[model samples]
Target: MLVLFLIATTSSVGFAQIYDLGGMYTYHYRDGRYSDWGDFSLHGSRIAIDELNESGVLGGARIRMTNENTIDYHCWPENAALMAETLMKKGILVLTGAGCSGPAVDIARVAEKYKIPVISNGSNASMLSSAEEFPYFVRVVSPSEQYEGYLINVAAHFGVEEIAYFYTTDAWGLGARDVIHEYTQQRDINIAQEYSYPRDTPYDEIKSYMNKVKQAGIRHIVNTSPTPDTVMIFRALHELEMNEPGYSFYAAEMISADEAPEVVAGSLGYFAPMVELVPSPKLSQFRDALEKRLGKPVDPSSKAFFYGALSYDHMLAVGYAIRDIQDAGESVTSQNMMTYLRRMDFDGTTGHVSLVRGTNDRANMPIQIVNSHGYKDNGTTVDFVSVGRVDPATGELILNEDSIVWPGNVTTPPKQ
Candidate 1:
């Protein structure tokens, strides 16, 4: 239900040429569950559009972006493909988003059929990394395989030889599970128990699963569930008295610190392949602009905020390709845009951005290992803080051990 039209002013000598860009965003679920991620992403793209227009990167050319809400059809593959086709009929040169993995897959299929480039900031299923499968698809975020190593490395760092693995039976979850299995084998870590739950499994069922985990005497656990489901798992663990000093949980997905911060306060942290916003003038300006757009204060620690950065990078990449094509005195066509994007490399807000030649996945992206806890300055205010990171180049796990606050405010890691 969100639609925006951006028009750039051109010089007096020439008429402004217009190009259409399409977006498929998730605003809410079929059951009336609301999410702010879509707004965050849309505003991020808006910023890039404003920058490109004001910078006069495209001369007399102006880009018009139209976004469609995937409401009532959130994460549905057929709906996404249909939406893409609808936008393509309008002569959109490029497409962006369908944030969830399921819909992202279908959007990519439409992109290939139409020969237009599609970029996403959220979808990270490993199967999408296949260039043969999705030629015109590219994403700013790294795939699940890129950061699943952090789970195994964190386990190894704590000298935990065995852990229970919990995942949902979906594309993202299954892909993460497979990658984690491979990494665990390489690290000689044993998965003492493996459990798969359907998406949207109730809290009571999750509690039952936790009971089995307790019975198996598994204190260390790795979870690859969605954020809401991860929160439910944390709640179940708390109810079962499993959120003790000796228990550890590492998540492949980023859990929202705003949701159930009390419940998720003490477990092991989650992995995020996002740019950690440091204090800089550029970051301050970006935050101010976004805050103004949202009519609210921005939470620097939230995953949605970081996803905004990725969205900005996505649009920036498209802008770069368009500029490059125009500078070469070539028509801005879909095939030409894809040609430029396939080998695009530039410093972006997130960091140094480069697309892998074949897979179109961002290469050597750093992974931040973060945990949610009470802020050091004010114990009452909880937030996510970086405690470690995985090196993009070497895939080495580095932990700031002293900075990590374990469950119950304990400074030392729990004993295995």
Candidate 2:
């Protein structure tokens, strides 16, 4: 009887397992303490774990999270190898939540070298999935190239024939501006004007260009920049009273949810590809748990589940791969693990998992537009209209839902 009790106690203790997920958090500008932007990714990972635990998927699993400060200071290629080594030593199988594209690529190189997959929360850059560099990178978020195509489709719907392009000198702006220009050309769309300005340059320049656009009868404006800069552009527009029946602007995902609507008022619209986790029964319960733990409502735009969801899915993939190898009575080597991951299929909260052709290929991503008219600063319902799916054949959107404008799960009351 005593021997049986000992076996039961040992079995209970041995059932629990720990998994480590490598993560990197980048922020805007630079601040020593925790960044609100950084939390956006962390919250994503936390929400994933919370949901997995509740669902009994990770009932006895513990996750050790690590934050790589690539955003604080740009990490070099060598540093990436060092970081990967450290994570590998700790038995980490995945790297998630890289915000900066450059550093994210560095991490990707190291991960691929080590045969560990890096899942990104940052806006998709084709370089991360290119045949040359990317072989182990997977992006949950849709690529920026798709955003340009989406806006083009939406603009056509609104009777916008000509568009003026204004962007920053930053890498994101340059990449997006170039790709969009090419796409617009292919579609036979007329370009009223194209202007690029430095990040620290005056909003006066953007306004000056806007004046030209207005004079030239250009109605649609596409601004590809961060929230701070985007706000300046709109402030300039507001000052000029550029608000008109046909005047509109589309923006990238860099626009912060907190300030995007308030800055633009009801005059502008945003275009980008975002993951829709709202209205999810699993997500709602996770939100409640987060509130109970944090003692405050999770910010709607915090992207609290971004990294969390990616991490949970990453671990789930790893766990299933392990179970498969164990079942086959094969030793779990990196090569064997790759074989399992290559053909692995699992239904995750994020969606289905069927990798694209190459090593860096990820699942299909959807595009949506958020027109923040009735949204407030703290909380607002983001108007998420399904635009299209990312088409692997042409790397463009296969737009079927031409204009299915839908309400977000959370909405701020209209101003009185």
Candidate 3:
């Protein structure tokens, strides 16, 4: 599911003066903790704006941007909706973020009420794809279907017949769960059982769930739950010594092992997104520049393309949409921006992006497959590496290696 978006106009290359456009970054996670994707997306937007100003993409016009941090953790959009209302009251019609799924829904409600445009990297629930329901909404990220397909394709490829599923109850989780339901049926992979938790589920309950999981005699578990919940599950398994052997756990969260490196060795695999092993020079340049700018190492797991870039693409999409509107001699307003955005398509740091097909989805970005390579340097290092890629266009599962490295140094899919 998407968690971010914004809109703006484009300028002729010959334009030499800076003009004003309203832009703001809005985000709210379910809890107090921040989102890696959201933070990196903000970074991506700034870098894109920097490049736009430098290139005079606005025909002597530049964007003046601000940020809104909505404080809430229950997926309640009241705080974010209020934030959007204030921005609209202040005459800022175009906005780009609501990085969490739940808040995105309320932000869209505000956008529709204001009769303005809102491009978001927010909620990725497939239901949000309805233009009739959310005409003011747009997403710059790929659909949740792509990630679900990644897991399904790999599982089927390894001859896995029955798998277990663990998902959350929120929009992102529901969207992915729906995708998984459809795909598993298509692939003939039986879901042996399913489990779930809410945004505020307690740790003891998670431990109790693991007791049930162990009793179920399941081997392969497909996890698309929230990061914290997954961490708790994995830790419970580690303590229970369920990480012993013949247990396979895979998740889409790239940073799953960061906080609990000790629990994730051998058994965990994940979707390695947005970064190319053979980095392009342009991507390399952007990474270095951003790393230097951030005063630290830049991680690509939060990426939309290179270095987990999404807002970069969304920001560029805004510029292109705005330019298209201006080319038609139209003033840049919410309606005008939305209209042009429907026809605007561009290739940016996030690969191919388009919303003209009547959907706010990115097209043709692959989710790279990753397997835990096992840690080295005395179990301090978490070594999850690229093992394959699931192409979005072709739906092919291509593995880099002949065999996968499962937990406990087992180099094969755990048998049922």
Clashing residue pair totals per candidate (backbone < 3 A): 0, 9, 25
Report the lDDT tens digits of candidate 1 across residue range 248-315: 67876565434544455534343333455555665666778789888888777777788777788788
Query: What is candidate 1's CA lDDT for residue 58?
Result: 81
Alpha carbon deviation, residue 400, candidate 3 (Å): 2.4
The residue-by-residue lDDT of candidate 2 on 73-146, one tens digit each, is 22122254566556655556566666555456666677777787666655455456573566666655445665
Tens digits of per-residue lDDT, candidate 3, 22-86, equal: 44343334555555555565677777778877785666556656544222233444476777777
Error of 3 at 314 (Å): 1.0
The models' CA-based lDDT, in order, is 0.74, 0.57, 0.64
What residue runs in model 3 are displaced by over 4 Å at the alpha carbon? 1-34, 67-78, 270-278, 301-308, 374-382
Q: CA lDDT of 70 in candidate 1? A: 24
CA error at residue 104 for candidate 3, angstroms: 2.0
Measured against the true structure, the TM-scores of the candidates, in listed sequence, are 0.89, 0.71, 0.84
Q: Candidate 3, residue 128: CA error in Å?
A: 2.0
lDDT of the structure predicted as candidate 3? 0.64
**Model 2: CA > 4 A from native:** 1-17, 27-38, 50-62, 66-92, 100-102, 113-115, 168-175, 197-217, 226-229, 260-262, 277-280, 298-344, 377-416
